[model samples]
Target: MPVYKDKNGTWYVMTRCDDWQGQRKQKCKRGFKTKREAQDWECRFLLQQGGDLDMLFKDFYKLYEQDMKARLKQNTWEHKACVIKSKILPYFGEKSMKDIQARDVLTWQNELLRHRDKHGKPYSETYLKNLHNQLSCIFNHAVRYYDLSTNPTAKAGSIGVKNAKEMNFWTKDEYMQFSEVMMDKPISFYAFEMLYWCGIRLGELLALTTADFDFKNRKLRINKSYQRLKGQDVITEPKTKKSNRTIEMPDFLCEEMQEYFSMLYDQKPDERIFPISKSYLHHEMDRGVKATGLKRIRIHDLRHSHVSLLIELSFSAVAIADRVGHESIEITYRYAHLFPSKQAEMANRLGELKKGGGF
Candidate 1:
């Protein structure tokens, strides 16, 4: 009833529906080459209009993307979109949303676990977890919106591959040694110094501008972050609400920043403090690591090192979380083991108290 032939012999599907406000409206799609295609399109369109479960995953994904565009940040949307297009769609694109069962999802998860990239290495657990999360999100969205009766991901337990590799971080002595080698490269030295001492994320560090700093008050504001997604540089809000915070810089670091500012010709308020790309930063870090003959770690380890140092100095978890713009103290607790053990000192004090007969 909804299919018709166009003037150029192509077929079209048109459906009339009542809008949310009760007004009648027509939804039409053209350029179908066959009557069957037109009828299929009409069927799906009508089902979608009636909020029935009749669309394929690929079709539902289009609607999901439109819903997400208004709710998610640019970087998050882009990441999810990339995952869906590259990983999820290839396997489940044509499958009906209602027909994708737990077993099917489990099979896909196993395939992902066994999948090897060009490097012949299986995807990291964190990456696998992210991919699983994206899949779960799509299914959950479908269930919540009544497009599907159940979420297959709910029963597809633990799709993420748990790798036991320990996270890498540097101690104070190692960082000091690395800094000694970085001294010759002024930009790298300053950048690493801020990263280590401030404990800001790489994106937050890259987003820094002259106006964000207050040398007189020894404070720095973190309100935004910079990221490269889909080969484009994007500036967006900080990762979380708590990430938008003010940090009081140490006196020595404040002085170093002042000296660094003096050498820069462009001192405009909006001028970027560190106008370097991620690749350049990695290059300098690699050179410094090799020259210092220290344990190689990612640039992000500098943030971990900063937290370790603060914990060593007896800073509370809340204090460290505030300084580093962590969403919660529980995140800081992840580095609890890195804190220097005070057990020996506590035992020594107890011995002294016993010797003095003070209980």
Candidate 2:
């Protein structure tokens, strides 16, 4: 038997029953605003308790978080989780997994465009788009395995971002100035030198171990990268298949690496080549650049400088791509303009051909 009351304090319905053993069950629950809502809840509860809806909101969210963390790399998970904590949870934390819809996602996307962070910087189109992408990925897993009715973000499209002009790499003189600034810091100097000569990523550079090098053979192996994981830094395998490669070291760098190896001979096999934290290295580099009045340059720009120098030396695009571990030669072409002086050199070569008077 059951009893229900409306919002206005009026009774809606009452039911009673007696057991076969003549036992009376006195269950008097009230407070639903309407008879229909109470009836609907009654039916839903019965079905839900009988396992008709096995996937609860908390269960789906738990699975979503687990799958996202497992599939995404540690840095990626941390970044994406920042977005979810700051943006997604406030809106949808209490939302039912089954009731989420495309409109809800669309509204969230629109709101994100208008929202700004505590720092007052508006969200970039790329950031918004990536957040949507991560959300879609989460929902996709839920839809595929958790029995979600539909993916709320299925219709979401990329936020249209205009292409910006390519950036300029450091000129030879700029590199010299940067070099002069870093001369006193051996690790910083050698790290920058390796970037300009070896085209290794910053993370890969930090992940280097003495054993990963063969100074006598003048070769450097890149197999792992230092990535931030769970708020701590850890060494992990390269981010992509193409990210693992061996590079030939210049004679000067080979000499330096040999010295570095000799100095580290007493250290453990797993010790970091540059035992300094990334933040400390960045801080030192910034101080050096400021003291020398050098042009502003990002750490990544050192790798860009390496690729540019190779291009200026007329290294084939395929070779550069292989050296830099780019999956495609097209990506290598992005650095072609770094050797723009070749335009004039090619023009001169064309003039020489014209002197022969041939097409």
Candidate 3:
């Protein structure tokens, strides 16, 4: 009854609906090519207005976005929104929530795994997992709030496979070799030194200001991180509660930072220590790699290198976790392989006890 034909030969649906406060409002949707399509839309719209379980995924996503805006950080909300827009919405936007099935989700996930980026590289396992999680979050929200029958994503299983390539990191000697190249670029030298010694994330490093450094106490406080989203730079709180920590700097590094700060005359406390963009940092690292003739590794690998060094120094996992801002020692267990020597030493001590006939 709400379907009508427009003068431009398009079909439309017009209806009156009650808003949240029970106030009457007019709702109209146009541009359907056929009367049947317009009628179908009107039926769905009426059902939705009547508080029934009939709503398009695209429409549901709008509600989801509003819910997430208050519950999630801006950067996290932006990431989930991007995944919905670029991946989830393209496939499910027009489908009703009740119409989506586990099979459809599984098929879509497989397609995502098979797809390649513009550079012809497949999406990383971590990235695929993030996408899967975002999809799951949306469906879970729908099931809980909108009374949807089930979450298809719940039955879709894991979307990303574990990465096959071995994790790459540098040894102290290799890092020293790289440092030789960094010496010529003072800023880069300081940056890499901090990254290696402090084991801070690149975002945390970039967000640093003079106020964060306590040269007198040889300590650095990490409370914020820098992120680039939608072509704008954003400063946000640390990723986790444990990420907000203070790290002690070695005496030599403290002396170096003192000299570096002196070079920046008339600098404000709030101004970023490293004001350059991430792309510029990458360029400098690439140049350093070429100059040093070292095997290439990402900027993030500097943190791994620091962890390996700490493991080699016989530091406890708990101590390392606290120093590196890991939420727990379980997170630090990923570097267990680097401490194989400790395991072997324990085995040797057990053998000695066995020989001595002690329990």
Candidate 4:
């Protein structure tokens, strides 16, 4: 490596490389402000010849984003970029990829663990795990493609857990109480009905249009999901292939929606059934919960409440999974853990089976 300075007070670096025809070539890059900048450029130039691992983490992350951004949905990529820019980059942006060790990763994890927000709140365990996974993923990419020794995160181990908290949901009676409170507003009532009865995601529910409902057959077709991203409303494919499904509507719900539709003046079939923002739905929930004095739950908990209702009705995992568009029956079975009160009921049924000489 050779760095030189001229009377003009600028620094430059030169390097030798082999040309295509087996000829020696001298490449010079100039106009860096400081000798450190010149040496840094020279170091990167030599390391480009050595391996990709010596590049700064930020530079490698750009490569990572280039390779990955096109493969993900816009909203998904936005979330990853936000996390990387906000949480991961500040600690390791300028560090060389190959120089980050398990201890360095551990140090970063401790700092994140102790981090507090403006409201004096720490990141959720799941969020901590998400950040760690993002950092670990970068290293994993290097190991798989750049011939790095190992993923330091694999050695450091992962923080947080997959299911950080138990499911929060309402029973049929509890939901009925809340639903009664929402009945004063027809839109709120019908929206909660769909969420509790169909077990669809908020995006899927918001994406529903008048044309999607077949009142004659009491069925609802779900194909697209709605997202409010970057200050625009976006309609994208459902969360999974299985999420593109048809749900059978309850007779009462079908009747209720029919009445609700009748109230709309000159609404088109293509228009959203509920042209309301998520904030509106949330506010309605707060109002309903406050009016009914019921246990407070998130809008998503309505979906869980639906699944639990199915479990209580003795529905099979496969049936529940199909109804909810779960990717696998195993996912539906995860809700089984939420219903521990069923243990005594199971024992009682087994006792009856023993008395009847049945296994």
What TM-score do all the candidates reach, one by one? 0.87, 0.72, 0.86, 0.82
Give the runs in model 1 whose Cα sits over 4 Å from its true position: 4-10, 17-23, 161-165, 340-359
Clashing pairs in 3: none
How far in Å is the alpha carbon of 32 misplaced in model 2?
23
lDDT of each: 0.84, 0.71, 0.85, 0.87
Model 4, 81-103: lDDT tens digits are 99999989998998999888999
lDDT of 2 by residue, 146-205 (tens): 566777787655452422323546767788777777878777877777776787888898
Best by TM-score: 1
Highest-lDDT candidate: 4
The alpha-carbon lDDT assigned to residue 67 of candidate 2 equals 57
Task: Give the Cα error of residue 280 in candidate 2, in Å.
Answer: 1.3
TM-score of 3: 0.86
In terms of TM-score, how similar is model 2 to the real structure? 0.72
**Candidate 2 wrong stretches, greater than 4 Å:** 1-59, 117-120, 147-150, 160-168, 231-233, 329-359
The true-versus-predicted C-alpha distance at residue 278 of model 3, in Å, is: 0.9
Query: In each prediction, how many residue pairs overlap at the backbone (N, C-alpha, C within less than 3 A)?
Result: 0, 0, 0, 0
What is the lDDT ranking, best to worst?
4, 3, 1, 2
> What digit string (tens of lDDT, one per residue) describes model 3 on residues 1-359?
65889999999888898888989999889999999999987887676665455788877787777677888777888877888899889998988878999998999898988998789999888788878888889889888888888899888787774443456888989998888888887788888889988899999999999999998898999999998988888999998888999999999989988878887868899989888778888898899889888888888888888988898898888888899899545545577677655578889999999999998
Looking at candidate 2, the ten consecutive residues that score lowest on lDDT are 46-55
After TM-score superposition, what is the CA distance of residue 120 in candidate 4 from its true location, in Å? 5.0
